[model samples]
Target: MLTLQIYLNRITTQHNGATLDYRGQFSNSRLIVADFTQFVNDIQAALKSAAEKNIYTPPSKLFGNLRATPICLDVREQLADGLSPVEYKVLLETLMAVCNSRAVKPEQVLYHGKIPFQAA
Candidate 1:
């Protein structure tokens, strides 16, 4: 099974930054490793594109908090460095947990390459 404790630093228009925690878990039986790998690959590709563009756009309002420009810069750096399987799986689980907690489908939170912006 995979587990994640996702912290969403919500950056609303009124609040610069607000930290929130969300927890979720998925078993190996629930997640096919190949699908997870493809998902990560797609994210990697999108990160590369965002790096070239110098900005990452959020797919949904739920991720708006993580939309700060500096976060994207950091993401670009992280993407350039590359992610290991463990990191990628953790990321996948974190996102899944966040979506589950928010009652938002994972597809709704899709922003393959863009940074999930958080600001304070």
Candidate 2:
């Protein structure tokens, strides 16, 4: 199983909108996403797609460093094929759970999961 961790560093709300500062860690690599609300939306959409289609396509924005890394669900499976439909659902649920928590101010561990991994 692969372990993934996401931390929400801070949230800034303005009259126009709210921006979230967060980071994700998988293995030795760490990714920082700053002031991106679309990231959350993309995750939610991917979760819906995974549920409806049993397939996950990672968000384009995360395609670079984040997606390039090998975060496998199983030792024998490639990253692309590691996650089962149920696993995908659970992974997204874990993330959404953290997102829904609405923990503001101070850094918070948004998500932590050990799963057969893959994310759309």
Q: lDDT score, residue 90, model 2?
A: 40
Specify the poorest-scoring 10-residue window by lDDT in model 2: 68-77
- In candidate 1, position 37 carries an lDDT of 44
> What is the per-residue lDDT of model 2 for residues 66-111, given as tens digits with 9 covering 90 to 100?
4422212111223343334553444344444433432211111122
Residue pairs that clash (backbone atoms under 3 angstroms), model 1? 65-117, 66-116, 66-117, 66-118, 67-117
Q: Summing lDDT over every window of 10 consecutive residues in candidate 1, give the lowest-scoring window.
A: 6-15
Q: Residue by residue across 1-120, what tens digits does model 1's lDDT show? A: 111121121111111242222222212332322244443444444434443454334334666435422221112122333433454445546444433333332222212344342212
Residue 22 miss distance in model 1 (angstroms): 29
